[model samples]
Target chain A: MAESDPHPQSSPVEPVSPPAPATAPVDAEWHRMSPRFVFVGTLRQLRGLVIPAAIILITGNVGRGGSELILIGIAVVFTVLAALGSLIEWWNFRYALTDRELVVRSGIVQRQERVVPYGRIQAINVSEAPLERVAGIVRVTVETAAGGTADIDIRAIAQDKAPQLREALAAARAQARQADNGIAEDATGAASTVATETPSATTGGELLRRLSTPELLALGATSGRVGPMAAVVGATLQFGAEIMPESWWDRIPWQQAEALQSVGVVASLLFVIAALTWLLAIGSTALAFGGFELRRDGDHLLLQHGLLDRKRRTIPVARIQAIVVGEQLLRQPFRRADIRFESAGGEAEGAAGDSGVLFPFLPRAEVRALLGQAAPEFATDPTVPMSTRLPRRSLRRYVFGATVGWVVFVGIAAAVLGLWLHRWVDVVTWQQVLLLLMATPLFAWLGWARWRDGGWVVENGTLLLRWRSVSRQTLITRASRIQRREMTADPLQRRVSLASVQLSVASGLVGGHYGLAHADRHDTERLLAMLGGPRHEVVIHKVPATVEPS
Target chain B: MATNTFDAGEAGTSRVIEVPERLPDPLHQLDPRARQLWRLGSAISGAMFVGIVALGTFGAARFLPDFEMRWAWLASGITLALAILNAWLSPNLRYRYWRYDIRPDEADLQHGWFTRTRQLVPMARIQHVDTRRGPLDRRFGLASVVLYTAAGPAYIPALANEVAADVRDRIATFANIHDDL
Candidate 1:
């Protein structure tokens, strides 16, 4: 409950007292980031200069001859400033590990001091971007239950020191947890074994799933990013046309290509753009998640992946709140859907901004095996499709739910194509308007598919629900992890005794809530009882309070 | 300069922070007498609503030269009919559906007329509870208890003063029971 405060991160920093400035003996145990940090940091800082530098080099050269000198001067100033900032940051950043907490002190002016107790640390992430990797340094981000925003980021540390620090922290945390629980002497031997000689634990732990080259390609090919990427490329093309020299535009063979083919220029351009965007999407996906691997350590799952920016995240198995299996419109045809964990860590990413994706592309049949191996708790029902589906009576509601949007869309489309434009009477015929209505059968089929796919099952302290739009999404969450449960029935659904149940969990920056429509009234009650205390009978104005009435 | 972050160490963290002092028990108790109060409130609101609609449309009709006075009267008449029906029927139905049971472990609330909602909040999960009494609520000797959890807030509307005090204290006790108090 205390963790639910929107500004929970403030507490961790609040607990830390002001550090003794320029103190000698206290600073003896202080650890500084690797010197390679400055070089990498400066390069990162210079990234902001790319656009301005490019503008000066290209556009400035269009009318003026002094572009090179201006570019050089600006580059020098930027380089110097970036280097100075990184140098100052490196000099100021210091962290010390104590028996009780890991204390970090950063910033020279608006100093930020954060103290995270070993017991409070939720997960640890050690990553190396391309430059950091090249420099043989890694960035360590220590996250508490307060989530990622309140992270103590050690931008660069020598790769060798990371394992020692992690082992030390882990050992201390285990001790704290044992002392805190006061009953974990049974697992004492196991705890000590992992904490002691585990510098190479990243790769040495039990292997779960490693996305093969072909599977990686499949994931890239079937990704939903192509749609968004096409939009981006369209914008980029417009920008390109604006910036290009007049001579370059004149040299193009667009008219030649348009004249040679049955397809118009717009259609041919769309085809080329589609292909380019798809290729870009694949390349970007590969760059982001090339060698994805899920490895398991005791009480924790370590995921290591990425080609250009190598990342390793240690997610404690206990922290996982829910599991989401998503099937894209393209991938559902192949019976493949990506798997994601809605862990209590308030990050929608693992974090690739891909919704906590553990397995990028997994076959529907094999998802159970992967979850069983990686996270056994969420892998209760393999089919995920075989849960308690909506009743046959709810089919009409689903059909109506599906068509309400279509009706609105068709009405709008009719207004635009058939009536709105006065000049397009001949081109945009009433047949086209009727043609759009032809998609009603497809929507009706969609409604049928939704009815077929929608299901909810509550058993074994886990809640499993499957719902779909164009793409299917299946959710598996433990009862105890649910932060909130709500059941609602609109006026229409009330007539048929159908209800909607929603469950929210502490995920992402705030939280993520998922729900299913048109569920049985009795099922929602069962769900309410899933994580609740004792169920008393309906007592209206009878049960007295702690004391007798006056 | 403080070298250590926390001087009290770990054991003292379990000390009670949210609930500092226990409240005195109330000598007088009363059940929620809210049925007539609720009906009167709705009836008043319905009358006011009809009056406003009649005045607003008629006012607009007067201001604009081409607008029809008959249409405004017709609009006001329709709203008046609907509001009278609602004001007569809904208050009792709402009171019937609203149910709240606060146990030592969890607080359960089953309410809503059209879109029925059931919220079961565990005592441990209760962030805070607030009892509010408005001017109108005081006239009827009624109060509302709002229970805030990490996820969001749920409310038990229109409770007697003594009952609200009792519910608040019981929730505080149950919540503290989860911690090492």
Candidate 2:
């Protein structure tokens, strides 16, 4: 059993030699799991895979008896198998850290085993949830120095035994650390002195800091996703009625004013549907934005909330790859924002669809403070005023987009109206064409607004790109963290000697094209050179060890 | 003066150094029973693949949809040909490419055929090292050594005995020495 198992304390301990280190050993505590952990973890795991599979199977055979029966049988088999697997996992899973080695044993029939020497243990993380809090249990996750997918997770371990496990792990870690630093083997004399005074506990008030009604409202307002989802739903519901056979398509007449009067009934029904859709969308938005909070715990940050399936994630500050600050136009008034961290092997569904993320939301101030504590030099000081805004060259692209949009709108309208009315020649009246001609300027205005907000900066080995429509987002990342960088100029942009830059990082993409219109080629070249330099120049200093007081 | 970048062109000049005493691949010292088990598993897997292909080809002729039969045949034939070619060529290729050499500062690996690859992994860059044995490796008294860097991973196959310990110690030494750096 892995030490992360709920019953890790019960596992047999193995003895091994400690590697010598240069530094005096610090008392360290690794972690063990709580016994109840198996129950909760197995339940969560069951929901994650089986629920969706069951839903898909049931939906796929909604009306069929034979197929539905087969799917149900499969679902039942899976559930039974998963339950049996969990029982075996709970019974068989074991982990423990002795002075010498960290041993993990799992699997039912296969009886898999992993034994990591104390010298090879790298990082250890401990996490707890509200449920775990009530039960006095915590999860201990250990990362071995060995690469590959061989992480040890001990679920549902007793809270009391956690310190013992932590001490063992920490002792090993300290030994490893000392060895890395070239300290002597007998250096553990100072181990007791390095013991942490602070307990692994969160005070009640600290928990309250995560959410208040007003903050949740602000989070809702700043949440950029809600309005877009609402608009899509409303639009779909309104158009959905028209696609049905009951819409009475034959009553509409293009030639006479009486056609408008005849379609009034359908129009009213569409309006009512739209209103209902708007209400439902608002409800969904609230549900998504409800009960949000962010807090810090020791060297880790704890983010916990959920309208359903309450989740608590504790991430070590060092593991954070990058921080992104986003603002939607509606949230601009309050300077409300969402901050997400890029993490490795993220569990969220959206990451699989788009990119990996650790946390999806946080206040702007909290984000800065967190970054300042972790990789302080990497986060561009938020107080710094953006030196450059949109350039005049952006107007060209805006004009281009606006022109294309107007042409497409007019073309579609002409084709639909001409075909339906049987009057191809006179389908577009002079007034409609004039309206389209006028809309080009309106679109240009909107486009100009979008471009004006875009800006970029390279500071302290960190790259910052802030862009928005009505809302704005500032993305900050370490240069060493960047996985890929590309600069490209379109044909027209090339003619104008303007280019855009994209930086890809482990978390995802930080992208914005600076339209360097009036700047000389030399200026663009200098900027690119700086952007492409080694990572140290961006963030000069690592984050301070302690969190700053607000 | 600092050593110039490693040059394969100066192969003659690249003096042979004694192999590390605690190398990572010395697993052949393990009892013979383990080795036989490893080889047996590999043979079983290869036989299973052959059996599956034969059965699939014969069954596919009767069960495949008319439209898909052509594509199936083409794919199956290609797969079979590749499998057979691999079975024929793998031993020679493995023997030709297999080598582990340690310089004073770094480890060097030479492998691959059509596109020969030579890797010079600086001791400083390695995050960790691992030695592993599969069922097949157990049978042949062979083991594979893997070196991991923050950037990526490299694998060495069919190492001789007594290499695993040496590689692991050297890696641990390097990791410890350069951790902060």
Candidate 3:
């Protein structure tokens, strides 16, 4: 394997032999991470100064010779200072693996140390940026089960040593699990013993799915990042217009052009904007997930992808908090969906945002098969009638809710015409009233569609909550993963005996909450009862205080 | 108060566990000193508002030729009215509505005036507990207990000092959250 080199140039300490025994000492000597980390750290510090440097250079008074020289001197000083600081940080940072914990000591001025137990490690990711790839090094990020951001990030390490570190950590975690099980067995004789099998220290894994070039291109084209791309393009265009030459505007005929010609210009501009946005989105997606591949290795799911910065993310199946299958407005008609995992720790590599997208784009028909193969635990029986649809009474609620905004808008227009403008009868024509009236059916249709798509299902200890706003999403998660369940009713909902059931899971920093809105109160209660039904040992009760005569 | 018991059927033994009639606890008021804390907070905000009004009046007198004092009076009157309401009426309403109870396996919180909310945090999901004392709380000999779960942190504000510490300790013990964890 490419990740098992014996002679690493960066490490100051000799590499510890593989498979450290389960009974290793509690306090191990600290070892510095790869010395190449100083380079990575310097790069990170310099990255923040790029825009400032560019601005300084662009706005510098080059005509005044001394001022330009001063600016260049200041830039050089800052670069040197940043490099020195990165070197100091690299000197201060050291990490050690104890018997049960990974201890990291860092900070130059005020010393700080963090200890993460092996049992708490949720996932490990190995990624390389363009610079690190050039240096033949990788960045390792360790995520704990704390459900916040990543616990620690080793910015740079030799590519060959990354896998060895991962293997050692996995082995420690397995031993910790065995120790925990042994203690539990001693406490309760009836407790079943868990197998103490370590993950195989090899690269081979069962290939579950791989995206081909054509499919990858299709994914890029259908990515749901058009909105962000459009914003970026709009900002860029605004900036371009500000910096554009005045002679360019003078060349165009503004007043003499025909109305049709102006309209044609506007239409072409819109087309250009849309095309640019589409091309940007596709190019970005292609760069991020060009060679996406998912493989199952022992108990971990390995994801490898990226074009410029090739990356690998290993996620244990047990750490996944929820699975989100999303169908965007543009891709639904073409029968495509995006699959994402909400894990306990930070996002996996190449996951553009907080979403740990396993596959950016996949055929809708094959989603079930993929889920069955990749994560069978989340797959439920398709034939079972588990969906509890909202009633027709709820449709009235939805329509009223949807149309309230339109009502406000029309009321404002009427007030302006009748009171301020005093053109009530003359300006408010029947055609305008008809156009306003048309919004009612449009809102009603939207309400009906939302009600049609919204439903909740519980099967095999997993709850599937499906809802739609602009796009439809079905969140599938184990009922046990839910930390809290809430059923709330506003005054209006209470009048209709409708309530919203919200389930909070331990995924993201604030946690992920999925709500099934406007469900019947009885049904919500039934669902809550079902969640608490299977637990045999513990039953909690709230005791009301007895009122005393005052 | 009613008791509902459900019987668990095993091969030879049948055991019944008593369940409460309601899923939430009966309303329990917060510390009486919370009213004083609320009043003090309102007073501080009211003082800041007065200062701002004074500054605005000075700015207008120096800068503008035709600055009406009636608008300033109206704004101050509205601000005072809101401050008075928050200082006097809101505290009572909040105290009446705010209630919390910690069970062996879960914690139930019911609060809010117009839009009532009831939240439950299972003990098993609790991550940590903290007791916070701000300046006013310290003056009033009161504290607030914050319970952190994986989802987020929820606070029980304006409890007596001893009660806050006791609640924090009890929750920490119940959740099995050690200092190191």
Show where candidate 2 strays beyond 4 Å. Answer: A1-173, A179-282, A291-321, A326-337, A342-378, A381-550, B1-57, B63-79, B82-128, B138-142, B147-165, B177-181
Candidate 1 lDDT over residue span A1-550, tens digit each: 2222221121123123323322112322666788888999999999988888776667665446775677678789989989988877876677777555665656544333444555545346677888889999887876543323435688898899877776776666566556665535522422322232222336857888888898888888878778889989999998897999999978989777567456476688788999999998898889888999888887677887889888877675656778888888788888887888876532223331113778888788889888898888888643544456788888988888777779789888677766667574444667766788888888888898888888877677787788888888888887666666777888888888888888866565445678888887666666666555343332223223423212
Regions more than 4 Å wrong, model 1: A1-207, A233-270, A291-314, A345-355, A384-387, A414-429, A508-511, A526-550, B1-90, B123-128, B133-141, B175-181
Tens-digit per-residue lDDT, B31-117, candidate 3 = 767777878887788778867876787578557878777666776677777777777877767766777766555666777766656
Residue-by-residue lDDT tens digits, candidate 2, B20-40: 221222111222222234345
Instruction: Please name the candidate that would achieve the greatest TM-score relative to the true structure.
Output: 3
C-alpha lDDT (0 to 100) for residue B110 of candidate 3: 70
Return the clash pairs for model 3, or none: none
Candidate 1 local accuracy as lDDT? 0.66
- Listed in order, the DockQ scores are 0.08, 0.06, 0.14
- Fnat values, one per model, are 0.12, 0.03, 0.15
Interface quality of candidate 2 as DockQ:
0.06
Q: Which residue runs of candidate 3 sit more than 4 Å off their true CA positions?
A: A1-204, A230-259, A262-280, A346-354, A381-386, A391-393, A400-444, A532-550, B1-29, B46-54, B57-62, B177-181
Candidate 1 similarity to native, TM-score: 0.58
- Order of the predicted models by TM-score, top scorer first: 3, 1, 2
**Best of the two (1, 3) by TM-score:** 3
